[model samples]
Target: MSVIEKFSLKDSLAIVTGGAGLLGKQHVEALIEAGADVIIFDINENALEETKKYFLKKYNTDVLSLKVDITNEDEILKAKEKIFKHFSKFPNILINNAAIDPKFEKNSAVNKSRLENFDARQWNLEISVGLTGAMLCSKIFGAEMAKNKRGIILNIASDLGVIAPDQRLYKQDGLKDEEQNVKPVTYSVIKHGLIGLTKYIATYWADKGVRCNAFAPGGVFNNHSDEFVNKIAQLIPMKRMANLDEYKASVVFLCSDASSYMNGATLNMDGGRSVW
Candidate 1:
């Protein structure tokens, strides 16, 4: 088969949580390019509608936009029902891309102190949104995929989850930026924990013909400052942050039959950052 045909997702049903975000929108677009029917799920209604219009106009394909608070089970169920009612089947691919940065709120994990101010509450919020939410979504989506006896799941993780941060790498940003680095306790801890969950579900659900995997992307240059991006780029072997196409390739692989043998695997699309 040709390269495109090998990875084609024609007629597949895809659900991409957090489809309104920068990286999420790229993912949705790539899936649509690969010929899958997509459902974009996000809590931000305005952004979701904007994404829907853009995709419809650009791709001339029907895309569903769901206003869903992923952390809430009832809300997720309602979205699922809507998806089923419209598509008439379970999603063949689920992309768990919904996550919150802990440093967004001023009172949040903004780390005013270095090696001294480690707030548990700040850490907990990261776990709630980044880790716990992914787990819950996996549970619901996996069950649905199981019932159908076929599907692919790709969970988004960070390279920081694999390796701890170095204080030296945070010099340009000062101690405050260092403290707020994504490698801080909560986000890294949860991401590491997410890998464990991915393995477990992949093994336990192997018999059901469902595959679970993770894409550990390094320093996506979305919403991060130039100094922050530059500081991070130095540590990576490739000396660059990830592009949308790189992230999209790995995501599409996890959702396609091309990666059929890759279950319980954590594909690091970090430009060799994790290797260092």
Candidate 2:
């Protein structure tokens, strides 16, 4: 196929978890722009409906939005049934984008997210949403894709997954050492775990025509404090946080035939942060 044709997702069906969030919405748009029928699974009913209406108006593509709790197997199975009812078949692409990454912004009231005083309950909640949720989705949705002997699973990871979290980026002054709102330990753990999950899924389904891969991105600029942005910029060779739309092209490449031969790989598109 020509390189241009390789990028086309005209006949593809993609399901993006957390598809109503900041980055997830962009993933939906990218897939739709590539001519793929898209489905969104997010727990936020309001955001999900809004995303569905907005995208429906903007693109002339089939878009289904479902309110799903990814951590629950029953919910995931129900979602699969709905897919069959609506789209007549299972999706070829599953974007494991749902996560509970607590922001460690300065002055934020983050008492339990700090590792020093982190609550075990909070850990379980984040892990369930970030790691376990992805697993459940993969297990339920991936089986259907395998029956067709073709699929792509893309896990949304972070630059911190490849490298250790630089706690300094989140440090706030005038607080006790215990009160310092460092990057939550759960965030790093979950991201790193996703990369591991990607590898396992890749090998497990290689013979079934499935490709599992991931991408590690640096901070995306979302009106973060100038202090935080500048601090992170210094670590990246590009010297700037990524724009909200920067990941759209990469997602299209990975989810479409463009990355047909690619599996068990993770592209670290982190503005040179991991290398630095």
Candidate 3:
């Protein structure tokens, strides 16, 4: 049998947090393709329901979409109980895809002059969702995996976490034109922390058969402008951002038994952007 067939999830259950977002929905779609029953945990009830409708129609698989807050342990625990009651056990796979990328959502033009003005509140929101949410989900679901001696936790990190950013991107956040570095303070800080968390948990539970790892994807154009997307494309060695298939493939590997031996390693799925 091929890897897709042999590596099928079959009776396994996979829980993906932030399942309503751009990347989160991709994770859910990949899990369903691999034959795993999936449960989506996100705060957006409408988006979650929409995702459920999409999958139900396409794959004809039963997908559970739970409207829960990732930052709240009580909400997660309650969702866990429901999952257990329905599936009889905790999920064998956990994909931490929910994150907040701190960039201008509405503005497209680059203003090199106004580099020092930024919302501290925006930065905090990024950290809370990107870092805190990942930590919480791991603590909750990882414990269950340890007891069963089988589980895979995939943390979605970013390439920016590895390298410093150019001042232009953050020039509006307060950087002189001559400054060589301009990092998005909050997003970068949190992704760095997530890598540390993955290593810590991997070593702490190596004997329990739970493998924790990460995938740092570069420049995925979900809803960004063409100008912004093309600019990021130039930096990559492959000269382009990854397509949906590329992202889906990497995620599927981490979810399936093909990566059973992998732990605490962050795979750079940047289309060779980090090298340049």
- How do the candidates rank by lDDT, highest first? 2, 1, 3
lDDT of 2: 0.90
Top candidate when judged by TM-score against the true structure: 2
Q: Write the per-residue lDDT of candidate 3 for residues 117-184, one digit (tens) a residue.
A: 54667666777788888888999999999999999998888887676554453333343454423455
Per lDDT, the best of the predicted structures is 2
lDDT for every model? 0.80, 0.90, 0.80
Local accuracy of candidate 1 as per-residue lDDT tens digits, 86-150: 98888988888888754433334544424457676766766777777787888888898898899
How many clashes (backbone atoms < 3 Å, residues ≥3 apart in a chain or on different chains) does model 3 have?
5
Number of backbone collisions per candidate, in order? 0, 0, 5
> What is the TM-score of each predicted model, taking all chains together?
0.89, 0.96, 0.87
Assess candidate 1 and give its TM-score to the true structure: 0.89
In model 2, which runs have C-alpha deviations exceeding 4 angstroms? 103-110
Task: Give Cα distance to truth, residue 206, candidate 3, Å.
Answer: 0.8
Write one digit per residue (lDDT tens) for candidate 2, span 53-130: 898688755579999999888998998999999979999999999987675445556566577678888889999999
